[model samples]
Target: MKNKTVAFIMAGRRQRRRRWILVTSFLALLACALCCAMLLLGSTIYPIQDVVRALSGENIKGVSFALNTIRLPRMLAGLFAGFAFGLAGNTFQTMLRNPLANPNVIGITSGSSAAAVFCIIILHTSNAVVSIASVVAGLATVTIIYLLSRAKPFSVGRLILIGIGMQAMLNAVISYLLLVGAEQDIPTAFRWLSGSLNGSQMHELPALVISVLIGTPIIVMLGKHLSVLELGEQSAASLGVNTDLTRMVLILSSVCMIAIATATTGPIAFVAFLSGPIAKRLVGVGFSNAIPAGLVGVNLVMAADLVGQFAFEVRFPVGIITGILGAPYLIFLLIRMNRKGNL
Candidate 1:
């Protein structure tokens, strides 16, 4: 009997490890494919070799304009933002053990959108100023949510409800700002409001990349702690997890990534909220799937952007496409979760 038990345990452990390895490899390959697809997509097609050459420091004129000046930065922004959203969303959902704890739900994206809209419309700040304003607003929004949510016993539901209210109010302010602004600024503000990467320039890409580079490792390194937290706060505390500090650090890192991404690309919608769970489901993993989540986030943005580009005469922002895709799924989740008393 003892020998049988030991063998069963060993088999389970080996299976878990095998699943992790398989998921990780799949994510890595998917990321590579996304990069390649993004490089090759657009009004004008460029060869994969030319794309590589341009990236490798050889300038091929028209190819340089096509790859470097245009597609590369946009692709990088989508990649990093999607990854951050996925990682951050998974962090919150795992820590809180709730599917709806994504940044989009928590109002971070709306907060950034509110500020970006204000800058573009009322402040007449375009180009760089809009990004700075968006980041500032996002950080502010995070602080507000933390305070509103830090009462007793930490309720994720209260946090989400308050966040939704705040989102509505901030959106109202954006509308007011637009209402009072000059007619000429309206189109630019509209673009920002729609959460498109259409106006993204190469200059804005570096700051975003740097922010992601710093945050990604932090989230990855905390994977074990996050997994432990999923066992419940009591168990995590018993396991020496310093639950509060770890959670705070993860949230801050996630916020920074999302804020920077929002500033760069506007609120690209549902990438953060949906990618983590979808990836987890695909990998048939438990809650320790933030890495796969991030990869799915990347794949989602690239795929959605491709769809937006080709499906219509007018290019749609990936955010709009994501909203269309994610809304029904979210409703389905809510309905099922409510029926199961999980909400």
Candidate 2:
């Protein structure tokens, strides 16, 4: 009787999990369709038929160059970068089991901003140079935060606190640079800081896409290790899970995604922080949907970019839209965390 009940419970859990995945997968598809709609339904309003033609090879007069060159790259960049950030962010939060353990909450994005700010203002560099600087800075920030938080063991809470401090310091430097920069240079610095996927070049797209392709699978493949790690380090070790090696590999792979995304587009915003929680609610809590989180990130970036581009006269970066949306979610998370005594 006891064995039968246990088997019944397991079967039920599996069925429920499958349902959860199906629901989230459907939502992801919806978001992707909406992205295409936004791409086509811009100020010009190119019909989907023409858009598809231009996308394939059937050049459609004036729409071809505009859609293919301008909007397509921008749309794709936002999509991929958002996906990368979301996947990475969720991995960290889930691995650490802390709501605040996201790429944005840490100084990672700030590092990119700081480097890009310096390049724009003092270096007077071109776009390529700025992107390079952002990647370097992102790596440095990640390294610092990782080192500071890791002693004999890992502590997610301490890591977040330190990351917040580091972010504040980086922000102060960026602000100071902007303040003293020549009038013309300030705008460049300002734009990089704000995070935009606008004006994405066709050249960068291949490289960015390739990086995502490479790193995404590594994240997905590591699911087994993640599951083990969730069982606690000692338990994982006893169970033949190499905790240190897995953590290192996961961190490296995630950083690659982040650096590539940040380089291609500016570090957008809260997709990383928000996607994991949203996807988790849809999927089972025990399963890690790093890919799903990435898709959510992609949806977030593309959607925000579209809204920012046409929703207002100013044509803001996708980052601003995300900031507006994410801030409220973050506050709610904070309140909830407090209520749960995790704060």
CA shift of 37, model 1, Å? 1.8
TM-score of 2: 0.94
Q: Against the unseen true structure, what C-alpha lDDT does each candidate score?
A: 0.83, 0.82
Deviating ranges (above 4 Å) for candidate 1: none
Clashing pairs in model 1, backbone N/Cα/C closer than 3 A: none
Cα shift from native, residue 244, model 2 (Å): 1.6
lDDT score of residue 245 within candidate 1: 89
lDDT of 2: 0.82
- What TM-score fits each model? 0.94, 0.94
* Stretches of model 2 off by over 4 angstroms after superposition: none
